[model samples]
Target: MKVHVHVSLKPGVLDPQGRAIHHALEGLGFIGVNDVRAGRLIELDVADDTSDAALDDMCRKLLANMVIENYRIEKVAA
Candidate 1:
């Protein structure tokens, strides 16, 4: 089984790195560069028996910070 986890900051949280990247893009003459938000993608291959409940536990325990970020889990069979 393969799983993809996306972790991102909730709205209203300042993203300095994203802001800097956006500025750099603008300086490079890229137009219509609207807002930018940074995030992370985690890919994992687990045993076929891994359950949704277990994946959720993984996210809550190690993949995401509930206080500042949100996470989504997607599972696929190998």
Candidate 2:
């Protein structure tokens, strides 16, 4: 099975990398850009029998920071 984890900063959290990207876009003459939020995608290939509970635990314990980040798990179609 293939799993994808999308991790990002939550609302009200400061994202310096996002800010930098936004600024760079503006510098490159891009317009109509309001804001940018940076995030990460993690791909995992696990056994077909892997349970949802275990995947969620992986995100909560190591993949995502419970303090100011949020994560979503996506199971890819084979």
Candidate 3:
């Protein structure tokens, strides 16, 4: 089985990295760019029997910071 995790900063959180990237893009002559937010994607290969609850636990414990970041999970066929 394959699992995907997306971790992103919640609204109103400071994102210095994203701001830097946005600035860089503007410098490159890109127009109409309002804001930029960055996130991470994690792909995992686990046993077919892995439960959804366990995957959620993984995100809560280590993959995402609940205070400032949110996570979404997707299961895929391998």
Task: Please list the Cα RMSD from the true structure of every candidate, rounded to 1 decimal place.
Answer: 1.1, 0.5, 0.9
Q: Would you give me the overall lDDT of model 3? A: 0.95
What is the C-alpha lDDT profile of model 1 across 1-78, one tens digit per residue?
899999999899899988999999999999998899999999999988888999999999999999889999987556
Flag clash pairs in model 2.
none
lDDT of 3 by residue, 1-78 (tens): 989999999999999999999999999999999999999999999999999999999999999999999999988767
Tens-digit lDDT track for model 2 on 5-26?
Answer: 9999999999999999999999
Off by over 4 Å in 1: none
lDDT value, residue 68 of candidate 1: 86
Model 3 residue 10 lDDT? 98
What is the clash count for each candidate, in the order shown?
Answer: 0, 0, 0
What are the models' TM-scores?
0.92, 0.97, 0.94
- The local lDDT score (0 to 100) that residue 40 gets in candidate 3 is 94
Judged by whole-model lDDT over C-alpha atoms, candidate 1 comes out at 0.92
